[model samples]
Target: MAEIAFPKDAMRVLKETSRTFYIPITFLQKELKYSVASAYLIFRAIDEIEDHADLDNVVKYEILQQVSELFERPFNNEEYFRILEPVKSIMPDVTIRLEEWLQACPMDVRPIVADAAREMAWGMAKWSKANWNIRTREDLDDYTYYVAGLVGVMLSDLWAHYADEKTDRDLAIGYGRGLQAVNILRNEEEDLGERGVSFVPDGWTRAELFEYAEENLAKADEYMKSLHKKSILLFCRLPLALAHKTLNAMKEGREKMTRAEVEQTVEEIQSE
Candidate 1:
């Protein structure tokens, strides 16, 4: 058997198209890296399927079914295992996580992504599901939490494996949920732009955003305070910070978010 490359392309694929996770996961001990990376790659692929319009629903369904099949078998062909092939060249620790992502499958989630892919799928689905049921804003809120809040739940599970006696297992879910909540509020502008939907910023005012931020941040801080590990904090830092920053950006952008300002903000983040 060959070794795995771990942090190389396989992880690079995991890192692509995001400023949030790449640098942060590196803060962990060597043993924890690939499991986190593997989970990310699977989730990211699912995201692509949902986000990419070029791919048709039938193709997406096939990809989803392939994910189901991959989990049922520990062994896969090079194409299905493309993400792992590079890692197998230089990294040995990857074998375990690679197996985990391949073995366990969840159904209540019916989440088209992998069974193990996390709540983000549910949340995104709910966001779209809102189109048919647009009677109340609370319904919209429920959708965001499903897709994003579940991220908190899965992160807790992943973190629990690496934490020692000092870890506060009790608080992992709260922290994850906090992170998701902040994201939902931050994306209010983007959500409205893309879906013509508004779970928040019904009127788009700085005062409302500030109050919402204060409320959500209070909850996030509670979870952060509950955390006993520095690694988790480091992982939590950039996103929650960026989420907070995005809100401030929206306020600075005011009601009319110009194309230039959003592009500049994204560029600044990528360079950072």
Candidate 2:
């Protein structure tokens, strides 16, 4: 068996791609397994195609085209293998399983999934020309939904296939939305400091945006409470619980949360 060592290269891609998601993803592995991890890894590549500058355009498109081919007709090769090598090594069954997933994807889903992927690719496609306009929350919202919200949709399907559909999938979907919002919000300070850009531009001040972000988070909490109170997959609860802790920190008037506080909150989540 391949040792379950960290996929350092893949983890680097994950962290640069989705800073907040990296850790919560560790918890999700217990609930969603390595296939979900590989799927998310693919999205992270898609995300990097949009966000990271060190990468070249030709490289990104090449990667995307290969990804398209992989799902369009699953095959393993050096390029895909080198990139996803760690994942493949860790979960030797991942390739066959991923092909099975695509085969099972509805033929009609090509549009919906393709639309989502394209919307995501467009955002990245134009990353070099990222607009500073704040009026594009709709644009960002659409992007987030396409990339992450759809993950919720797929995850719901994944869960339902393995177990009963939670009457709470709607709530899970809300939690996903809230998570996406918080991510956009959390990156504001960095994006501004780094690039003079803001995702929600003018309608809200940073504090107001933080408040707006938390409103979605609060909805996520409501969805968590709505889950069967006695459910045992409590690890799935980590994301919501962390959202609550992060929101609490925001409410406490800190300009930004201290790393120690955030770490404490994560510890509280695992311990609780």
Query: What lDDT does the true structure give each of the candidates?
Result: 0.50, 0.52
- lDDT per residue, candidate 2, 1-272, as tens digits? 11143244444555555545566656643334333444455555455444544544555555445555544433455455664443344333333233333222333333334344444445444433434344655665555565466666555555554445463655555667677776666676787776566677456666766665676676666755544422224534666666666666656754446778667766866676
Query: What shift in Å separates residue 99 of candidate 2 from its native position after superposition?
Result: 11
User: How far does residue 17 in candidate 2 sit from its true spot (Å)?
Assistant: 7.5
**TM-score of each candidate structure, all chains considered together:** 0.61, 0.63
Candidate 2 minimal-lDDT segment of 10 residues: 95-104
State, as a TM-score between 0 and 1, how close model 1 is to the true structure.
0.61
- Please state the error at residue 131 of candidate 2 in Å: 4.2
lDDT of 2: 0.52
